[model samples]
Target: MERPSSNGDCYLSLHNFKQGGLVYRDYLFTKDSLMVFNSFGDGPISQSTGAREYYFFPRKNVIPQFSWNSSDRRLEVTATDGNVVFFDYETTAMTAASNLLAK
Candidate 1:
């Protein structure tokens, strides 16, 4: 996951591999919160389904204070519920170049 600057938007992509298939979800960060946009998989997933569900029942409020450790390739996000979620990511050349341009 690439860290977003304050007031910047970030895309979060989650992938679950099981039963020889892949389940994926795409979310966007806006106003310090996450909103689900697209998803595909099987079974009853617990995540928010679509725009309506996300608008009505959003995910946890994420604080704007994002921490990114380039060396470790980790990102830390704090939520309003006093919980923290950490993500480890791999950066490609395109992503790294894009991040530089963003800065």
Candidate 2:
């Protein structure tokens, strides 16, 4: 939300917040996959977040795509290897609750 760098280059850190832990994020960019994380203070804690990942598929014949199944409240992804992955989301209201109930 803020930039705490001296030269105003680091766009990840907070303005006045001095965070000394790991931070990372992953999102689908224009490329196949792109993610970045940076650690400003303390030792190299960024590595603790997770290992960096990169995925690139040949755009010749394989077309990896994603679609949202609104009826099932899921986002399905078809990979280049013909593998399929579905991410189901909870769209119910707070009062409606979810399958996870308290003991």
Clashing residue pairs in candidate 2 are none
Candidate 1 local lDDT, 1-103, one digit each (tens): 4455566654343332321343344444343444544444555555524442122123445433356768867665443333444555542111221111111
Instruction: Return the top candidate by lDDT.
Output: 1
**Runs in model 1 lying further than 4 Å from the true structure:** 1-23, 28-38, 41-62, 91-103
Worst 10 residues of 1 by lDDT: 94-103
Model 2 Cα lDDT, one tens digit per residue, 1-103: 2233465432211111332244323223222432333333445554344434345444221444556678977655444433444544442111221222222
CA RMSD (A), model 2: 12.8
Note the Cα lDDT for every prediction shown: 0.40, 0.37
Judged by lDDT against the true structure, how good is candidate 2? 0.37
TM-score of each: 0.34, 0.36
* Model 2 TM-score, all chains together: 0.36
User: Ten residues in a row with the worst lDDT in model 2?
Assistant: 92-101
Per-prediction CA RMSD (Å) = 11.8, 12.8
